[model samples]
Target: MKSTLAILAMAISVPSMAIAQTPPPYQPGMGDLMVTIVQPRHLKLGLAGQARNWDYADYAQHELEESLEAVEKHIPKWRNLDIAALMAATVKQPLEAIEKAVKAKNAAAFDASFKQLTDACNACHQSSNLPAIVIKVPDASAFPNQEFRVTRP
Candidate 1:
């Protein structure tokens, strides 16, 4: 009777012990998801906006925002960087202006806002000690067969 009880207890306790163990949280030092994902998306969105490809710009904006959110969700704090807030301070104004222009369908306003967004991208890169990664308004179409001209709907 005691042997049977001991076996049963061992079985229950063994599974419980296995279940209790968990992998440690990921803690990469730098050049993590923020750089690998978030930063590039930000630069691309700015370039798309500058080209006045509203449809593509909107998509890029959504992608950039989602990437930023994902970075924050996966790794909320990195190297003591208030990553979300830092990103906000750099991009918020330009993003808001772009949203307003996009709503109004004002080409002039969109152009100006796009420039601001590009500048912000550079600013952030410089602030992050990544000045080598310069961003600018695209001069020539890089994506072939894709329209960047202002278009309806």
Candidate 2:
């Protein structure tokens, strides 16, 4: 009877033990989430900035920041680029500059900062050895189905 009780106890604990030892969080690979989220948001922000749609630009910038952060947290390493530092050095400044220009309504500064940001994106791609993933100031809206126009409301 004691041996049967011990086996039952072991069986009951096994599932709990497994549950307690959870697996590490699932992290997508580099270039994976960037392509999925970062790149698109970056493009949208640029397009919105160009369109002078400052309201949507704010949201897009936040999303761009989040997307890059997600990449750094989920997939810390890329082919040769240290994503965290690269993001700080290459992407963050122009995003801030753009934010400032958008806030101040400085057309010239906005244009220059936007160009710098696009260049930085391309620079990052080149430095990461993925030059094929070229980024630019979007010329046209790919998301026409969604309104990008700035509304005074």
Candidate 3:
């Protein structure tokens, strides 16, 4: 009877030990957020602008901005540099320009502003010692399923 009780206690304790040793929730690093959140938004924004889809361009631009904000929020510091400060210094003005272009539905301005934004992105990466992570104006649609072109009803 004592042996059976000891065995049962050990079984219960084993599960408790296993639970205690469980790993913490996964926390995405800066690179993961950039690739997963920022890159796709940037690509979609470029495609929308290229296709002259002003409404979708506006939406994509906002998404890109939010992704950048989230990146700054999630990883406020990277390589000992303030991510928010870096973003403010590099991409803020270009994003504003892009916003203005999107609102105005001016394709030419959108193109120019998007280029400026892409340049700013590259500059930020270069300054952050990530020059190999080059960003550019999307020359082709990476998302084949999404229709970037404006459709008139």
TM-score of each: 0.60, 0.78, 0.89
So what's the TM-score on candidate 1? Answer: 0.60
Tens digits of per-residue lDDT, candidate 1, 75-104, equal 666665676776787777887787777667
What is candidate 3's lDDT per residue for 22-134, written digit by digit as tens?
A: 99888999889989999999999999999889899989999999999999998999988899999999999999999999999998999999999999999899989989998
Worst 10-residue lDDT window, candidate 2: 74-83
**Could you tell me which residue pairs clash in candidate 1?**
none
Q: Write the per-residue lDDT of candidate 2 for residues 1-153, one digit (tens) a residue.
A: 999999999999999999889987776677678778987897788778777788788788788878878888876777666888988889899988988988887768878998998899888888888789877778888787877777676
Candidate 2 or 3, higher lDDT? 3
For every candidate in turn, the CA RMSD to the true structure comes to: 4.6, 3.1, 2.0
Candidate maximizing lDDT: 3
Q: Write down the TM-score for model 2.
A: 0.78
- Global lDDT for candidate 1? 0.71
Candidate with better lDDT, 1 vs 2: 2
> Rank order by TM-score, top first?
3, 2, 1
Q: What lDDT, from 0 to 1, does candidate 3 have? A: 0.93
**lDDT of predicted model 2:** 0.82
